[model samples]
Target: MTQQDVVSTGSTTEGRAPKGKALAATERIQAPVGGPGRGPMGGGMVGQKAMTFGPSARRLVAQMRPDRGKAVAVVVLGVISVALMSVGPRILGQATDLVFSGLFSRTIPAGVTQEQAVEGLRRQGDGNLADMLASMDHVVPGQGVDFDAVRNVLLVVLAIYAGAALLGWLQGFVLNTVVQNTVYRMREEVEAKINRLPLGYFDRSPRGELLSRVTNDIDNVSQTLQQTMSQLMTSLMTVVAVLAMMIWISPLLALIALVSVPISLLVTRAIMKRSQGMFVAQWRRTGRLNAHIEETFSGHSLVKVFGRQHEVEETFAEENDELYRVSFGAQFVSGLIMPSMMFVGNLNYVVIAVVGGLRVASGSLSLGEVQAFIQYTRQFTQPLTTVASMMNLLQSGVASAERVFELLDAEEEPVDAPATSAPAVRRGEVAFEDVAFRYDEDQPLIDDLSLVARPGQTVAIVGPTGAGKTTLVNLVMRFYDVDAGRITLDGVDITAMPRSALRGQIGMVLQDTWLFEGTIRDNIAYGRPDATEEQVLEAARATFVDRFVHSLPDGYDTVIDEEGSNLSAGERQLVTIARAFLTDPALLILDEATSSVDTRTELLLQHAMAALRTDRTSFVIAHRLSTIRDADLILVMEHGAIVEQGTHDQLLHAEGTYARLYNAQFAQAVA
Candidate 1:
């Protein structure tokens, strides 16, 4: 095929395009079974990809069991900080009262006896306590009171506040440590799950969506929780403590102080009620933006080839605008909470002063008492405002909590087998016994499928679009359980065995080969890390990967970029094939084994597959018939059922569906 004949990704050459043709035309197309790009359907299931947050986040934490101590320490620090803040105002008030008594001189008022003056001092102390406390706060000057003593008391108050502040800062530090730990642990878990999850999982979820959940969404929650533990919780404690003080000092004034609280709280609640939904939306848009970016970059080459850069940019702009709109709404509403609280607080202060002043002037209250009342009122309200502001953090934390919980609670693949025993083994053979599967329960893609690959023989599975060829391989690996039937290896059910054990002895190579960011030597030794260097090179040479590796800039030491994008598709395939060859498994499954490469690369892969399949149980799923002509058996699948089965020559002689497909493809190659 020349450049002119390079068709767009989903355009049909001769047959009808599968469903999702509309979405495919919009941007880069993903696997058919996976939903949109490679979605929940990519595994050819009706189930959406497991992209929820809660179960996933919990699992992330579970992965870092060692960090559990740090998480607990952080919470402890947070509680202590709250406790200190709650008691701070009262401690300062008590110290101020002591200084007031010491500074006024308890002797008689100029010639009165010491005993009478002591009695008078006791009387005046009540009258002076509020002013004394205010003076200690540096909010007023002491009259007939010792300035030195007041200074000493003020110093003590400062010490108390300083301790509270220190605890507050420490709480912040510990909370951040926990946040980072959670994120680190969660990220590790996501990576591990991604590695272990079946290929069908990737097929269903778009790479961008998963990336968003793992990276951005988790960050939002972590940041929110960090703030909640430090600032929000502390502020809430302070408000409660101050209110308790006011109510104790004088219930009347305390009642007046609280008049504005309900109004303020109402406004705060309304704002948050509106803001929380916006926040969730904003985060979702953030995920979509990430998904957009991933999609654009992943298919940059295709976009350039098709000259659709403008379309790409326009689509990106739309997603960006939506994100901006939602973000602005969320932040704007959350930001309003503080200023509104302050306004309501000031109003409450005015009412407290008016009511308290009348009582004081009427001699029902002492100056010190009134002053203390005012200070306590402000203290209570200040925390109320603070806690209100912190509500944003709380809502955010909860949202993240919800997301994290979703991931942590996700349906994990079963680990135990059913009570029933598997089929008795007659030979080291594998068979798909009436298997049917869908990623989701709603859609069934493969129905009543059955095939057999006898031990020491190679089998080929072939089909057109959505023919369930790859899904068959997934079942054999138990990457996914069949919805209807059971698959057996050596006549023993695959599902009955441990997945690790079942998959441990199986090797596979896919069309879009993936190589992690590592040295070429390491990539080949991935599954079998214990393999020797000699074994590594031998496998590489056997698969023809050594021919190219030696020619690279740094030979085997050269590092591959993400997904081996730096290498050509053929080179990537060669590396993956070599890795598979190194494993030397009992059963080998290759899906679209050589679909992406040129004729030369195809020939190399064909030679490599031939060597790899010798004396081993093998199954090859392919659209390219030429690569599998030598297979001992060929099974043709359609809509989840085995429609035809035979050898290459036998299928040709039978004049059935396989023969028609073979003839058509062969004629096309000749043409």
Candidate 2:
């Protein structure tokens, strides 16, 4: 979970969305996949498991294919490093033999030759001692250890080890570079993928869970590669190099060590099989816990208002406990590997020692060779153990990679239309020709809807909640495409025009205002980024934003806090209106734009909007019937169809859906 707390940045909707559409972000309504208590952003349902292990593991490896050159460099360095280190034990063994030979020379008593003394001892019935002495090379009868020779061999061993250490460090550096660079590109791809995804994808997926995939999962992948790859390469190489040395020293000892390989593999494979699912569950639970926490903090006020804090706490405890349980299980299962491998290694050690001793007693192998062989035995078994222990990291990384891959592979919005298809000139005349749409195939929202908003006209839309008020404006913006019919601007089909070009000519102010963490001037200029100071002030005044802004200490220069918590609801709405006004769009869309402000401010905004709507086509979705009293034409929608269309007075005279809605509101106001 993230340490930084962030307020939820979403707006309010007066009505719920149609089926197949995501519920307003603020609602706890359950979708098919993510139910209530799943938290906002819709975390994965309980008992959901990760993807198959093999394919995910393969895909992760494919990600590293681009870094093959650096990987090869690491491998080459590891091989050279291991080779050099492998030679050190043998050289040290030479030093040991020299010391043993010098100590034995004094006990031999000056003789014709060392061979003659060994033969005399053998004839005197001391066969075992004679045999041991026979294994020593170049031992003069009365000479002590040659300190100078021993020092030379010891220096060679030190030099070999130092060279090996240098190469090992170099290998690690290159491997780290490869892992970091690969992860960097992976992060870039994921970020780009997020932009390409459709709005609905976000509706279904939890924000916290998606964030976990993008941030925590990718970071884990990086750490896993960094921790395991270099060591894995070096350990495997050490095993190969040390095994070769062992075989050369004594085939019998080498064979004995090989006995542990199959046993170790069986143990590793068995434990990995059992632990993989636990790791998957561990990460899944982590995402759920994060989502719960995000929802709890983002909607903290509502929780307190309804006295749901205790319930929220209980939910959090449940998810947190689940995460803990799975995490502990994964760790406990994978942790058994090192000790088990160590036990097997110890048994092999005992067998090799006994066999090597017997060979030395019979003079089949010299004592120094036996000592070097014992060291090689440790070198071989140690790398095997190291490789076995890396399984835990490997499984965890692949699990994260699967989650990230799922995001990268999500369906994206269709590509934009060609620029050549764009209209030569954009006029504010919008027509819906026999349009039909459904959020879900079985449940239609709008059907055979046809209407036209002529240039310089204000078309007021009033309806009950879920009357497709926002959906109508959303269609104009092409936030979604129609299922059967085409919408046109200036007689040019909107689908033919590039979406960007079509949307650029339109300005929208939603009921739920959005303001970023920047100065008021910046937020107002968001719709037209290159707007001049004069243009900004002009737009602000026209939207009544300047009236309150100038009263503040910094005026337009005042910076909004995160999610604009520092601004009042009306102030934030006015800022958004000014942003839309600055664009000077050919068309305008307002969804209860004046809902957040008081009556006085609403009257001022009405006048401002009236002026701005001159010579511009505007679509106004209103819940307050009183607000549309002076509108040139009023469209009363019911069940996604326009049930009444005319001036406001005509609609009331008709005594249909519009009159009932208006009278109800009037009566409620009086009450």
Q: Each prediction's TM-score against the native?
A: 0.80, 0.91
RMSD in order of candidates? 7.6, 4.3
* Residue 502 lDDT in candidate 1: 71
Candidate 1 per-residue lDDT, tens place, 480-558, comes to: 6777788888867887876666777688777657677899898888878899999999999999988888789999999
- Candidate 1 Cα misplacement greater than 4 A, ranges: 1-35, 39-109, 112-145, 166-201, 418-428, 438-445, 668-671
What clash pairs does model 2 have?
41-206
Q: What is the lDDT of residue 626 in candidate 2?
A: 84
Clashes of 2: 1
List where candidate 2 sits over 4 angstroms from the true fold.
1-49
